[model samples]
Target: MAMITWITDDGRHRQAEVNDGSNLMLAATFEDVPGIDGDCGGCLSCATCHVVVDAAWAERVGGPGDHETVLLDTTASPRQPHSRLSCQIISRPELDGLVLHVPAEAW
Candidate 1:
Protein backbone atom coordinates (compact mmCIF):
# COMPACT_ATOMS: atom_id res chain seq x y z
CA MET A 1 0.00 0.00 0.00
CA ALA A 2 1.00 3.59 -0.50
CA MET A 3 0.11 6.64 1.55
CA ILE A 4 -1.29 9.64 -0.26
CA THR A 5 -1.76 13.05 1.35
CA TRP A 6 -3.98 15.81 0.13
CA ILE A 7 -3.64 19.39 1.30
CA THR A 8 -6.60 21.60 0.62
CA ASP A 9 -6.58 25.26 -0.22
CA ASP A 10 -7.86 26.04 3.27
CA GLY A 11 -4.95 24.09 4.75
CA ARG A 12 -6.99 21.04 5.56
CA HIS A 13 -4.98 17.85 5.22
CA ARG A 14 -6.33 14.40 4.46
CA GLN A 15 -4.50 11.18 4.11
CA ALA A 16 -5.34 7.69 2.94
CA GLU A 17 -3.75 4.30 2.54
CA VAL A 18 -4.34 3.03 -0.94
CA ASN A 19 -3.27 -0.16 -2.60
CA ASP A 20 -0.51 0.18 -5.11
CA GLY A 21 -1.85 0.90 -8.61
CA SER A 22 -4.89 2.74 -7.28
CA ASN A 23 -5.73 5.97 -8.98
CA LEU A 24 -5.24 9.06 -6.83
CA MET A 25 -8.84 10.08 -7.48
CA LEU A 26 -10.18 6.84 -6.01
CA ALA A 27 -7.84 7.20 -3.07
CA ALA A 28 -9.19 10.61 -2.19
CA THR A 29 -12.76 9.49 -2.76
CA PHE A 30 -12.31 6.43 -0.58
CA GLU A 31 -10.99 8.64 2.20
CA ASP A 32 -13.81 11.13 1.71
CA VAL A 33 -11.23 13.85 1.34
CA PRO A 34 -12.65 17.27 0.62
CA GLY A 35 -11.73 19.47 -2.36
CA ILE A 36 -11.53 16.53 -4.74
CA ASP A 37 -15.00 15.89 -6.05
CA GLY A 38 -13.99 13.14 -8.51
CA ASP A 39 -17.42 13.42 -10.03
CA CYS A 40 -16.60 11.13 -12.90
CA GLY A 41 -15.15 8.49 -10.68
CA GLY A 42 -11.82 7.40 -12.15
CA CYS A 43 -12.68 8.46 -15.65
CA LEU A 44 -10.93 11.41 -17.23
CA SER A 45 -14.14 13.01 -18.44
CA CYS A 46 -14.48 15.44 -15.51
CA ALA A 47 -11.91 17.80 -14.17
CA THR A 48 -13.41 17.79 -10.67
CA CYS A 49 -10.68 15.49 -9.48
CA HIS A 50 -8.05 18.05 -10.36
CA VAL A 51 -5.02 18.38 -8.09
CA VAL A 52 -1.68 20.11 -8.12
CA VAL A 53 1.10 17.58 -7.82
CA ASP A 54 3.82 18.83 -5.49
CA ALA A 55 6.68 19.91 -7.70
CA ALA A 56 9.11 17.80 -5.73
CA TRP A 57 7.11 14.70 -6.61
CA ALA A 58 6.46 15.64 -10.20
CA GLU A 59 9.21 13.50 -11.66
CA ARG A 60 8.03 10.47 -9.75
CA VAL A 61 4.35 10.92 -10.51
CA GLY A 62 4.95 12.00 -14.09
CA GLY A 63 2.92 14.36 -16.28
CA PRO A 64 -0.64 13.91 -17.44
CA GLY A 65 -1.56 11.99 -20.58
CA ASP A 66 -3.25 13.54 -23.59
CA HIS A 67 -6.77 13.00 -22.23
CA GLU A 68 -5.98 14.37 -18.80
CA THR A 69 -4.23 17.37 -20.25
CA VAL A 70 -7.30 18.23 -22.28
CA LEU A 71 -9.60 17.90 -19.27
CA LEU A 72 -7.30 20.11 -17.20
CA ASP A 73 -7.57 22.83 -19.76
CA THR A 74 -11.27 23.11 -18.88
CA THR A 75 -10.67 23.76 -15.20
CA ALA A 76 -11.75 27.07 -13.72
CA SER A 77 -8.76 27.50 -11.46
CA PRO A 78 -5.43 28.75 -12.67
CA ARG A 79 -3.62 25.77 -14.12
CA GLN A 80 -0.08 25.37 -12.93
CA PRO A 81 2.70 23.61 -14.77
CA HIS A 82 2.25 20.73 -12.35
CA SER A 83 -1.51 20.55 -12.65
CA ARG A 84 -2.92 17.04 -13.14
CA LEU A 85 -6.21 15.21 -13.00
CA SER A 86 -5.91 12.87 -10.05
CA CYS A 87 -7.71 10.10 -11.91
CA GLN A 88 -4.75 9.77 -14.17
CA ILE A 89 -2.22 9.31 -11.38
CA ILE A 90 -2.06 5.73 -10.25
CA SER A 91 -0.42 4.97 -6.94
CA ARG A 92 2.65 2.79 -6.87
CA PRO A 93 5.47 1.74 -4.60
CA GLU A 94 7.46 4.52 -6.23
CA LEU A 95 4.81 6.96 -5.02
CA ASP A 96 4.71 5.68 -1.48
CA GLY A 97 4.40 9.12 0.06
CA LEU A 98 2.96 11.15 -2.78
CA VAL A 99 1.53 14.51 -1.81
CA LEU A 100 -1.11 16.36 -3.77
CA HIS A 101 -2.47 19.83 -3.03
CA VAL A 102 -6.13 20.31 -3.81
CA PRO A 103 -7.01 23.51 -5.58
CA ALA A 104 -9.57 25.90 -4.08
CA GLU A 105 -12.29 24.54 -6.30
CA ALA A 106 -13.00 22.00 -9.03
CA TRP A 107 -15.01 22.54 -12.14
Candidate 2:
Protein backbone atom coordinates (compact mmCIF):
# COMPACT_ATOMS: atom_id res chain seq x y z
CA MET A 1 0.00 0.00 0.00
CA ALA A 2 1.03 3.57 -0.65
CA MET A 3 0.28 6.50 1.65
CA ILE A 4 -1.13 9.49 -0.16
CA THR A 5 -1.99 12.86 1.38
CA TRP A 6 -4.52 15.32 0.08
CA ILE A 7 -4.54 18.99 1.09
CA THR A 8 -7.82 20.76 0.52
CA ASP A 9 -8.33 24.35 -0.56
CA ASP A 10 -9.52 25.26 2.92
CA GLY A 11 -6.17 24.02 4.25
CA ARG A 12 -7.46 20.73 5.59
CA HIS A 13 -5.43 17.58 5.04
CA ARG A 14 -6.52 13.99 4.56
CA GLN A 15 -4.45 10.92 4.11
CA ALA A 16 -5.16 7.42 2.91
CA GLU A 17 -3.29 4.19 2.35
CA VAL A 18 -3.93 3.22 -1.25
CA ASN A 19 -3.07 -0.03 -2.89
CA ASP A 20 -0.64 -0.10 -5.73
CA GLY A 21 -2.01 -0.44 -9.30
CA SER A 22 -5.06 1.73 -8.42
CA ASN A 23 -5.38 5.40 -9.24
CA LEU A 24 -5.44 8.51 -7.08
CA MET A 25 -9.07 9.31 -7.85
CA LEU A 26 -10.17 5.93 -6.59
CA ALA A 27 -8.10 6.31 -3.47
CA ALA A 28 -9.43 9.78 -2.70
CA THR A 29 -13.06 8.94 -3.41
CA PHE A 30 -12.82 5.72 -1.45
CA GLU A 31 -11.39 7.61 1.50
CA ASP A 32 -14.01 10.38 1.13
CA VAL A 33 -11.37 13.00 0.83
CA PRO A 34 -13.14 16.28 0.08
CA GLY A 35 -12.83 18.33 -3.13
CA ILE A 36 -12.16 15.51 -5.60
CA ASP A 37 -15.46 14.74 -7.27
CA GLY A 38 -14.14 12.29 -9.88
CA ASP A 39 -17.41 12.67 -11.74
CA CYS A 40 -16.25 10.88 -14.84
CA GLY A 41 -14.97 7.94 -12.84
CA GLY A 42 -11.41 7.37 -14.18
CA CYS A 43 -12.19 8.01 -17.81
CA LEU A 44 -10.31 11.29 -18.09
CA SER A 45 -13.43 12.94 -19.47
CA CYS A 46 -14.82 15.27 -16.76
CA ALA A 47 -11.74 16.74 -15.16
CA THR A 48 -13.54 16.69 -11.81
CA CYS A 49 -10.65 14.80 -10.30
CA HIS A 50 -8.25 17.63 -10.85
CA VAL A 51 -5.45 18.14 -8.35
CA VAL A 52 -2.23 20.09 -7.99
CA VAL A 53 0.58 17.76 -7.12
CA ASP A 54 2.88 19.18 -4.46
CA ALA A 55 5.86 20.79 -6.11
CA ALA A 56 8.20 18.58 -4.18
CA TRP A 57 6.72 15.56 -5.90
CA ALA A 58 6.08 17.09 -9.31
CA GLU A 59 8.75 15.30 -11.28
CA ARG A 60 7.86 11.96 -9.76
CA VAL A 61 4.15 12.50 -10.48
CA GLY A 62 4.83 13.89 -13.96
CA GLY A 63 2.33 15.78 -16.12
CA PRO A 64 -1.04 14.94 -17.59
CA GLY A 65 -1.61 12.87 -20.68
CA ASP A 66 -2.91 14.19 -24.01
CA HIS A 67 -6.54 13.43 -23.22
CA GLU A 68 -6.21 14.65 -19.64
CA THR A 69 -4.51 17.81 -20.85
CA VAL A 70 -7.43 18.68 -23.12
CA LEU A 71 -10.00 17.98 -20.44
CA LEU A 72 -8.02 19.97 -17.92
CA ASP A 73 -8.57 23.01 -20.12
CA THR A 74 -12.18 22.90 -18.97
CA THR A 75 -11.67 22.43 -15.26
CA ALA A 76 -13.59 24.69 -12.83
CA SER A 77 -10.34 25.73 -11.19
CA PRO A 78 -7.50 27.47 -12.92
CA ARG A 79 -4.79 25.07 -14.03
CA GLN A 80 -1.37 25.32 -12.50
CA PRO A 81 1.89 24.08 -13.95
CA HIS A 82 1.51 21.09 -11.72
CA SER A 83 -2.21 20.60 -12.28
CA ARG A 84 -3.21 17.02 -13.10
CA LEU A 85 -6.23 14.78 -13.23
CA SER A 86 -6.08 12.47 -10.25
CA CYS A 87 -7.57 9.72 -12.39
CA GLN A 88 -4.50 9.84 -14.56
CA ILE A 89 -2.16 9.26 -11.67
CA ILE A 90 -1.62 5.59 -11.01
CA SER A 91 -0.50 4.70 -7.52
CA ARG A 92 2.80 2.83 -7.24
CA PRO A 93 5.41 1.94 -4.73
CA GLU A 94 7.37 5.01 -5.80
CA LEU A 95 4.35 7.18 -5.06
CA ASP A 96 3.87 5.91 -1.54
CA GLY A 97 4.35 9.35 -0.01
CA LEU A 98 2.62 11.38 -2.69
CA VAL A 99 0.97 14.63 -1.61
CA LEU A 100 -1.67 16.42 -3.65
CA HIS A 101 -3.47 19.72 -3.22
CA VAL A 102 -7.16 19.80 -4.07
CA PRO A 103 -8.59 22.84 -5.71
CA ALA A 104 -11.42 24.94 -4.27
CA GLU A 105 -13.88 23.18 -6.54
CA ALA A 106 -14.17 20.74 -9.41
CA TRP A 107 -17.24 21.04 -11.56
Clashes of each: 0, 0
Stretches of candidate 1 exceeding 4 Å from the true structure: none
Candidate 2 lDDT over 14-70, as tens digits, reads 998888889999999998988888887898788889899999999998888888889
Candidate 1 colliding pairs, count = 0
Task: For residue 42, give model 1's deviation from the true position in Å.
Answer: 1.8
lDDT of 1 at 19: 89
Worst 10 residues of 2 by lDDT: 37-46
Cα lDDT listed for each candidate? 0.87, 0.90
RMSD in Å for all candidates: 0.9, 0.8
Q: What's the TM-score of each model vs. the native?
A: 0.95, 0.96
